[model samples]
Target chain A: MEQAQADKNNSAIRPVLFCECLEKDGIVRRVAAALLGGYAFTWGFTALGTTCLVALGMGYAEAEVAMLLLAFLIFLIVFLWAFAAVRIDRVWKVLGGGAVLMTVMAWVMQHLLLH
Target chain B: MFNGFRIAMTWVHTWFGLVLGFVLMVCFFFGALSVFDREIDRWAIPETRFEPQPMPSFDRLLLPVLEQQLSPDEQEYAANMPKLHDAGKGPMTPRLELPVDEYWAYTTHRDPVLAAGGGFRVPHPKDPTLENHIHGRVTIDPRSGTVLRDDALKIGSDWFYPLHYKLQWEWKDLGYWIVGLAAFSMLAALVTGVIIHRKIFREFFTFRPWKQTQRSALDLHNMTGVVALPFHFFFSFTGLVIFASFFYFPLSHTLLKPLHDQHAVLEAQRAGLPYERAGVAVPMASVDAMVREAKRRWAARDMAGEVGFLTVTHVGDANSFVSIYRAGSDRVSLVGEGIHFKASTGEVQYEDPPRAAVSEINEFLTGLHLQHFEHWLLRWLYVLGGLLGAVCIATGFVFFVEKRKRQHAKMGGQGSRVVDALAVTTVTGMVIAAVGMLVANRLLPIDLPGKGDWEKWVFWAVWALTMAHAFWRSAPVAQGRLNPAWCEQCWALGVLAIAAVLLNWVTTGDHLIKTVFTDTYWAVAGVDLSLLGCALIAFWVGRKLMRPTTYEKNAVNRALALHE
Candidate 1:
């Protein structure tokens, strides 16, 4: 009976310890996602936005400036979303995946324009 | 991640604000001083204490100065010469023998001296298309064309102003990145703060200094944060925008370099300006006549102003042109109305048309933050806004520590103690360092070798000492008592501020009476008066801190009654 009681007590405490560790790790992941992922997404957005705008017959300088003006606002939004999102994986998918997709598209577009 | 959006937002606001609050404190405090950077420069360097002067006569005054062969800056030469010169092409050119490629001068409405520089071309460049020029710069008394000592640092502009944006950390632009991240965090904190602050309107007018420490700190934090919300948002936003192209998102010069170069060439072709030097030597036309014509044209456009910036590109070359830009002192924009003149013939090549809508917006955003326009009242308002930002951040630190110190003490955590020490160091310690630098400036001999460098050392040394003192006294904070360092440093700041003013009087012999009334030199007088004001406030705060808190006083009374 004492052995069973000890096992039960250990089981109860183990999950609590696990939950606390998970919570700390979650916070670290969220902060990293917010800053580093947010920066990547914003960089991609600026590149693609400027390139697309330039291809759409806007002046290069004006397009660059307009995109830069909007970049920080976009970064702020994504940064907040990174923390507020229910699923960390989804945040990463959106930020990291979106960054890659947009960056590739921007590169292709710039290549076409130069050609 | 939290129970609700509000809670989540609060978490974000509290943590991010706490983490970046230290950096934000420096940014806001130095940013406020940068408002009157030129005035402070006048106070530091008494030799430049005269009134603001317009651009000197270029033909007579600036020409002779520019004509003199000048050696490149030693630091720049050492850093750039190897990369710029190709040893395989031939022998390296001596620093003084480099050909002058460009001449430029810049001044603002608040400047008493003109800053002029020359870019000398490096021979045998590894990359022909790249700009391979070593630069030399000098500050001159525009009225007499006398060069000021190059070693004398413009403490305000060179020190405090850059400290706000870059923290004076130039190692691979580490400071820029740190400040940029801090600025972004500022935007996040502002947004999160709004979401968590449900009764912002109600808290705008609330301040209960008599309450407990945490409550009063939060009250002041909310009040100052709310009061300067717009100022805080816009300044941070514009600061990011100003450095966007150069530091934050350098797409134009990097990923878009090809397109950018193409556009530049096409634009030059359309504007009938030369994109490259002709290599053929030619006697330059009179720049004074070009300035005259430019002034006449500006007057015709009903925006007559002094020349704020003038540049001669491709100097001594056939395709060289002179660009004269009108000072935007009367408006909220930077120097504009640029008129290009052919250097060989002195005829107008192209007068710049009005800016497009996007360009105008860009310039306005940059200009407002830069504050080149002459508006005394607006300038003070900017200073007040900056101080409110500093106060908001400082109070945030206080509330963070006060809310956590007791709990952390119970838990045997040193988190609150460490934070409180840093808070004291940044708040009182920062002011002490700045004033200490000023006192050292006045106390140091005028002709001392590397006087400016010594002043900088004093600033860093004083700040480090204060940090040491704060950390040493932080032991009491772990026990849930106030760190006496805060009150002690406040007193030190008060003393240092007064000593700085008095030392200025002794060294420069320009006391309040002579500066404020006899001669009416507002620059020095204004700085002196502001220092006195700072000292008065510091003393008042120190005295208040010396008094027992209401909690302590009540405890003492209850103990006495129980004994009786």
Candidate 2:
């Protein structure tokens, strides 16, 4: 009887402990997302966007200022997206994958298309 | 606690905004003033009042002045000109002309009437004053071909514009980076604020000034932040974009070095500026003819305004070119089109053309930001938006402190006290400093060495002193009372405002009545009236602050009654 009562008590407290940990984790993830999303993501996207614009027959001089301004808008959107996201892991995965794909495309454009 | 997006945004908005509100408030206040910057310039430097001259024909009227300047006798006269303050004694102290770097043939948009009448001006390289600047600017009554003023000087666009944008700190542009950072944070705060404002449309229109302090503060904040939300958002983002090149152009150089080089080549070719000075002496072709031709071309294209700026490159060389651009008021783009003329041959080298689409858009945005175009209603709207932004940010500071003061008092009162001091210094102190600078401008000897520089120093020093005063008086607020700093600063602002007005009258002999009657300089008169308005408002607020609040009166009554 005593052993059973102890197990029941432990089970009741388990969910509460789990909830506290999750709350702490949410805070950390949001902070990380803000820093990474606002700065690093912004830079990568601007680089990719400006490069792609140049490749698409837009002269660099014409595209440069617009691209820079668009970059600010992108950073704002990405920052909002980071916090609104339900899953932190998914946010990083999409951003990381997008960053890689952009890098590859930029490389191809610089090496093959421009040349 | 993490229940919704709005809650999260609330947290973000409060903390981020509170952190940078002080700097943002200062920027917004000064920026709002900079909208009528020329009016303030006319008010501060009274010598420019009622000074209007029509455009001079460069060859017939202004060129002779330049030729005479190149003369040996004129050169001797220029060389022996008295330095500022060195020749000074009293109010009649002679004003000294600044050393000229280059003679610029520019046009006046100081007053719309002058601008409309085709006011072309030769701002002598030595004249260093502000708008309609009488000094060193050789204005030939365009019709008469006669010299106007030999000692015309102005501290042109020197103080207010620079203070707002650069904090007047030009060394490595450190102030720019700081302002830029605050602008970025403002963007973040604005975005988060929009998110947190659940009933944004309703809340935007909802301002209950009659409610209790906390509710009223928040309502006022929402109304201002939401009402001018678009202006705040666009200005902050564009402000950064305009200067982001300082932070990101290096990245551009690294990533697309060849494109930049190619662009440079194309730019030079387009402007017809690539020709090096042919290593032979040649008498320069008539600049007046070039100006006339350029004007003709601009007029034919229906893009004529005034001689915005004329730059002569390779002055006496065969490859010399003179580039003359039109005034920007005729278009939305700050960057106006210019014709490039071959200086040696007087032949049209390059006709000004429309910019590429992207450049046009960028120029338009900057022009919108600058508002050099003549539109009184739009200009007033811009000023109103700026003031609204300032009120919103300042209220945010006050609300933050009001909400947390009791809690902080319970817990030792350090946090609330610091914020209160900062809030007091930034908002009230800034106003006091602004009025004080105008007073300093009026009081200082007109020919004081580096008058503009002295005015800038007075501004900073007064502002710094206010900060110290805030700290000293804010200590009592830790006991949960009102900080006397705010009231004191308001009273100071009143005195300073009135003093500035009186000094302007005493020094320039342009009192309110005379200014309005003479009416030649509505710009100056309007500025003086505005200062008077500010003084009246300050006095009213100061008197109101003198009366103790219900909380304070009760605290005292409760103390006496408990013992009784």
**Candidate with best TM-score:** 1
Query: Which candidate tops DockQ?
Result: 1
Error of 2 at B184 (Å): 1.9
**Across residues B255-336, which tens digit of lDDT does each residue of candidate 2 receive?**
5555556666777786767444465777778887887887888888877667776766655667767788877765767875
Per-candidate Cα lDDT values, in order, are 0.89, 0.69
Lowest summed lDDT over 10 consecutive residues: which window, candidate 1 chain B?
A: B1-10
DockQ scores for all predicted structures = 0.30, 0.19
Candidate 1 structure quality by residue, lDDT tens digits, B175-274: 9888888888889999999897889999999999877787799999999999999899999999999999999999878877877778878887889988
Write down the TM-score of every candidate: 0.95, 0.80
User: What lDDT score is found at residue B279 in candidate 1?
Assistant: 88
Superposed by TM-score, candidate 2 places the C-alpha of residue B115 at a distance from the truth, in angstroms, of: 16
